[model samples]
Target chain A: MTAAVPNAFDDPAYRQGVVELLGLLAYGEISAWERLAEDAKMAPTLAQEAEVAAMASAEWEHFAQLRDRLFALGEDPYAAMLPFQPIFQRFHARTQPEDFLEGLLKAYVGDGLAADFYREIAAFLDAETRELVLDTLSGTGHSEFVVDVIRDAIAEEPRVGGKLALWGRRFMGEALSQAQTVVAERDALTAVLVGNADRPGAVMDLTVIGRMLTRLTEAHTERMDKLGLAA
Target chain B: MTAAVPNAFDDPAYRQGVVELLGLLAYGEISAWERLAEDAKMAPTLAQEAEVAAMASAEWEHFAQLRDRLFALGEDPYAAMLPFQPIFQRFHARTQPEDFLEGLLKAYVGDGLAADFYREIAAFLDAETRELVLDTLSGTGHSEFVVDVIRDAIAEEPRVGGKLALWGRRFMGEALSQAQTVVAERDALTAVLVGNADRPGAVMDLTVIGRMLTRLTEAHTERMDKLGLAA
Candidate 1:
């Protein structure tokens, strides 16, 4: 199906969408950092406590960069971000991971999906916007330390695999639900990406998307298995 | 005041108090890092946001060090910290600064007074403990950015002096009041410091205490003036 393509920067709706998405993500990062830092206090060792706190703080740089890009796009960051509060808040409330492994799984799943989503959108944007989105998505090293922890934990507990695998499924399920809601409610924003691309239906390649998700799941499973979990 | 001096570390009451105070302060640092990471959202610029988050994260390291020291002294980190929660929580709640400058002011005042308090206690401890406390207090670069901000603000607005000066007063009043309360509630702890190698009273030297307070006040006033605030 043929779709109308528009210059993203010049489209007020697209620019506003950018602002909205960035603002919401920025706020999310700030809150995440706080929660992670506090949660670190539950750690049995001082070393782990410091590690979590530092990881929490590391999110701020990416949050700020995305925010700055939004501001530069002339969007009212807060206003654009307001529409996302309900769904985002609900996700957090529903998915408060009970254990350290669960928390790491949550991060691993969330960051991987987000990175994938943004990477897809980046392809449809102008060169400058594409670079910014790509940079923002890539710059935050969210998965490295998380993978390390999962690996170490699995090594210590070979039987932990099943619990973590179940946890991972739940985490992804919640995320998918959020994505569906966003798509259903945000046509203009979706249009900004899907309708803006030259190949039109190229954005709707289900096989490609499925492969990406499968790969992510596979990687996560491998990480858990390496840790001796029932992946 | 002819006060009987007690060997603080050896004295159960004093040792407990020391543990309690230090534990609270250590936990406070950890919480502060988390809060700052959260608060960095108020920053309008990404660079500034990252900087604040980094500082917040760094607090965890200090917290770990202090926690280790507390454990070394055979105290329950959480138990020692439980008593001062109300006072500390109240102070933080009342002084929730709205923006970056206010946040900086809070840090500056809190860190400065804490360092001074640590120095006072260091003198009464064993050489190793004293050295550890002093090193921890001195190594933290809490006020470096604050001084830069104050300098810049003063350069920008000459009339900001009065407002900041008042802020400084509020900070000091609250800190001093809490400190006095902590001290009054724990006479054995005071005996720990005052009773040392010399006569407890001679070791404390009320005149020296008065002089240190005066110097701190003067330094704060000078800072306010430099920040173009009324000193």
Candidate 2:
């Protein structure tokens, strides 16, 4: 390995952007942890409850790692994470699942979107920070578990699919609205994301961000489709 | 090391007892995880919330290890964990924390008692099972965290200490009631605990059980004292 500081470190604004992006992603994991822990309560069986709670616990480990990295970067992890909390709170408030299956869908669908967005943002960061961001967003293998349960339930009752499809659409709408609110408020994240229009090395633009959103939407739809729900 | 099977394996009843004990301990951890995860919602700060959630996650790791070991022993881990759910549900319902401090107290005081009891029970099993039980019962380093917050809160308002002391006593009473109920219901556990009064190698008697409870109470008092609360 070459003993060279990554290009991202050559610019202070880019460093700030990396920290802001990580803080936002870190808060996303923390909120996900809280939501899944709440969801565990509505699980129909102890074994199933353990499965859901296991996912929630995995989020905590990710959050701890992300928070530590944020601290290492000379940021107060909690303060850095503060701006994103209300965005999640608003999204969760609007999208509270009516039952256990809906909760699983949200856990699966919601995390899928967040993870995809974070993975995209990782591209603008230095190698180490990029790896840390990716590490924090890795799913806890609960995707299959969530899919199995939701698909089995939907198969057993075809009418339930219509109700969940509508719910999925509502979840997607709420998430995007809240995400736009976060992007509006967190200028550092916005800058790190699309970069300056005149910056020679800028890889992100309105076009790139638009394509990223499209990719994220495609992934979310795939997740919902796997659960036998329409996006 | 000798490949000794240990004395507990000589008797099928004792082996059943080991399984029973491990099952009970595993369920205790699983329940603790659920309760603490639920408790995380009441934390005043996100940092404190993560602290509580981290403890809950540690419990899941312990439960996973125990569950895998139970499967290795040709037992259905969930079935083994089933008998203790209602036991915990009853205790939690009776002692739901009214606020964040109360939740912290429950997390601390409740876990202290459970850990102490399990540590005592660890002595009666084969080496492997004994170690597994002990490992699961290890505290997630929450003692200092809980004590620091509770003591600080109480210091801010002296009257809060009195209220929490009463709550601690209530918690202790409810725990003992449920524990006796468990002792009454789980015959395999009972047989393993007291070692059959007529058996020549009987390791426990009414006297030993009495002493165990006494020691458990003393430990609980010390925990309460550490928090500057009355037992």
Error of 2 at B159 (Å): 0.5
TM-score of each: 0.58, 0.93
RMSD after CA superposition, every candidate: 10.0, 2.6
- Model 2, residue pairs in steric clash: none
- For model 2, the docking class works out as medium
Against the unseen true structure, what C-alpha lDDT does each candidate score?
0.64, 0.81
Candidate 2 residue runs with Cα over 4 Å from true position: A1-7, A195-204, B1-10, B195-204
lDDT of 2 at A177: 77
Top candidate, metric DockQ: 2
RMSD of 1: 10.0
Model 1 chain A — which ten-residue stretch has the worst lDDT?
A195-204
Candidate 1: which docking quality band?
Answer: incorrect
- Each candidate's chain B TM-score? 0.79, 0.92
**Model 1 misplaced regions, further than 4 Å:** A1-35, A38-210, A218-231, B1-14, B142-144, B150-161, B193-212
